[model samples]
Target: MSQRQVVQVFEQYQKSRTQFVQTVAELATRPMNIEILQNAGVMSLLRPLLLDIVPTIQQTAALALGRLANYNDDLAEAVVKGDILPQLVYSLAEQNRFYKKAAAFVLRAVAKHSPELAQSVVDCGALDALVICLEEFDPGVKEAAAWALGYIARHNAELAQAVVDAGAVPLLVLCIQEPELSLKRIAASALSDICKHSPELAQTVVDAGAIAHLAQMILNPDAKLKRQVFSALSQIAKHSVDLAEMVVEAEIFPAVLTCLKDTDEYVQKNVATLIREIAKHTPELSQLIVNAGGVAAVVDYIGNTKGNVRLPGIMMLGYVAAHSENLAMAVVISKGVVQLAITLSEEPEDHIQAAAAWALGQIGRHTPEHAKAVAVANVLPRLLEAYLRAGATEDLQTKSKKALKNILQKCVHLPALEPLLHDAPPNILKHVVGQFSKVLPHDSKARKLFVTSGGLKKIQEIKAEPGSALIEYINTINNCYPEEIVRYYSPGYSDSLLDRVEQYIPA
Candidate 1:
């Protein structure tokens, strides 16, 4: 039928008119027919049906409007501009469960369009209605409501807080424990969105007992739900030490570590991220992760050909190393040091290079033994190369420089100091001098090595200036040198004249 005939029939008010509108609404849902209805201005015809006396017609019209707005931003904005948000919010309060469910579906579609449209949904008091729908007996309505809340909260913190203020936390927690797998997944997703806003809000979700539920869900072996569950746990763990400790205490690491081997790249990536967040600033926790086989898992991911998997994995290794000497040693034991060195040397991605450099620095900072291990991994050259390479951002240069300094400070190999002295830039020369001052202390063997390595000559060249920091460094080294002494030795009774000889040795 033509658009005019359809409207005319609805205007005439026959017994079957509701069915006609419902059929038209159904047709509008199909991609092939949606454009025809939209071009026909069918939204204008269906707007009144949203308030139709018959609940089924209202339900069908809302569904059609929702589907039209599903993938089309323009139509969604149109729906919002038409002031349909308030009507949808009203429908959520309807006694008819089907109408409420359809209304929620429409609201979710509209809110998902953009942040601005989502704000409109919130402004129209959709949050209150959605929270009420969460308590609905109909599983479909509850699922749609949870989804709508998740979609709205995903865009902005304010809206997320609004959802939480409307008491969505406990409801979401309950939904997660529901028998229906789909509801559980959606609720987990919603909880993830809500917690992502801030630490306080994340703690709220944890307080609502989301951690236990999410932990259980993560073990389901359902890749899709597991992804969402890990995402939620990761967000929660990010905000506070207590939350992270809680997550660890819940014994979530085993499952989280297992996910690193998941075939799905996304799952693997997110799990790596979770491990990184949890391991940060917690030395014991870092070691726990190491003991749980996370060290090898992270190393394996860093070696993956896929950048997505490798980047986060590399970053996680850095976090683990940053916490403690033992964990740093764990990284080296896993042979992660070599992988990071290779990444620093050969990875085209500057971010990966920077992260690897940072990880190496963290490892080298612990002790001379750890620093030598990083040096032995051959990262020193790559670090210097990374610093000298053109077009490297200042941040990358700083990371490379710091990593090189860490290795050099603890690395007693005097040969490594020679090239740096001759070729380093002025600033780097100063740093090298400063590092050498610490390494070359008041000892005869060290002084001899410093002299043989042309360290004295390098200092003399820089000390030529009237005022130089090198003067202090030179004085420091000179003060450590053995004083010259004249020794009179009587070789035999026949030697009348004492042979005077001067020899420099440790006093």
Candidate 2:
């Protein structure tokens, strides 16, 4: 019971506690050790240490829990089930800066997995504490807090609104303006997650002067920072016309165009996505993109990349071309069709092909010149191939077919329409004939080629109902040539002639 004996005993307990936490922290670093740690009932072991009277012990415990929970949702759920979150949220308010960082890290690690786990963090009143941490003098603490808020907001709109209601937007905006590049990157990303859910939430971000501050870093040399900045701007611009206009007004086009060729693929993809969001709003907005030479830049990105990275670029072309004939021509003039055709042929994902097909259709639907631009790229046959493939997705089929119909109808160019004659389905065959009905009547030379190429023969064999447009189109095409020429190409004319000689001796 002496003072010396009591002091020795207290020191022994503190050293053992520190060693246990240090061991747990180290073990949590390797993915292989998580199972062992979990089976040792580590969650329970660590629960009380989270509030250990010593700050390092408490902080280390939170760090260990975060690392273990970060391994997978199962462990994250274990963290949730172990009721570790409330304590972490509680510590976020009471702890020192480093402890606050570790606490926010635990909350973020849990929230990053699923909406349900994020809800648990929110249910523990973590947002307000984390928002308070954003005001801390330490950059590390603020960075961790911003990152946690970003992850929580990323799950859904309601959770995002919860982060917003905690008064985090202005603080996050300030974080982006901070000198610490890491804080800026995460704050920018957190802003993206918050605004990506809905227009009202996006307005909150925009109202806080996020655009001008964010725009200031649009061309920041750090590729990671640029990616987040691009994403945040895209999220805001995606919501409404006025908001997109706000992004455009920030003079973001040149910097955005530069990032389209960023060394980082994510930066390239994200910036392309930003342009697509802007371009989808209206012809005026699309024109703004085209004026900045966005069409050519996006087309270049599509050409040089593969897989999902090219999707936003492909879609940007579609959105741009969809706006007006002038914009479509801008895409066409930039050789957008050529890159799009390559994606259609080379990209394996059906959705990417579908997007390419949809963009091509948008490009070719505007005028004969536009259609011819697509036609000369040898894209029509490929489009038909996509449409008719047995394995084609319904979306791919619909987009390709619509592209074919759009192009073929506007395609006054006879050569492109000729090959489709042999294989186009009856529905599409009608557009082919309709084009010939309009053009062959005006070009005697085309009528000759139609007969010699068996285009006439193919048409004669088509059995169209008398009153449908196909039949009417067939009639118009027939009237373009001599009646004998049409009869000579008729399906059974030769057989009828031979039957006249002998009924083939069969009844």
Compute each candidate's TM-score over C-alphas. Answer: 0.80, 0.95
lDDT of 1 at 74: 84
Model 2 clash pairs? none
lDDT of 2: 0.91
lDDT of 2 by residue, 1-507 (tens): 999999999999999999999999999999889899889999999999988899889989989998998889999999989888887887787879989999899889999999999999999899999999999999999999999999999999999999999999999999998999999999999999999999999999999999999898887889999989999999999999999999999998776788877889999999989999999999999998888888898999898888999999999899999888999999988989999988988998998999999999999998999999999888988999999999889999999999999898799988878899888888888888899899988898988888888888989888899899999889999988788888888988999888777855655
Q: Candidate 1 lDDT, tens digit per residue, 334-370?
A: 9999888777777777877888898889888888778
Per-model CA lDDT versus the true structure: 0.80, 0.91
Question: Each model's RMSD to truth, in Å?
Answer: 8.3, 2.7
Q: How big is the positional error of residue 245 in model 1, measured in Å on the Cα after superposition? A: 1.1
Which candidate ranks first by lDDT, i.e. highest? Answer: 2
Worst 10 residues of 1 by lDDT: 485-494
* Candidate 1 residue pairs in backbone clash: none
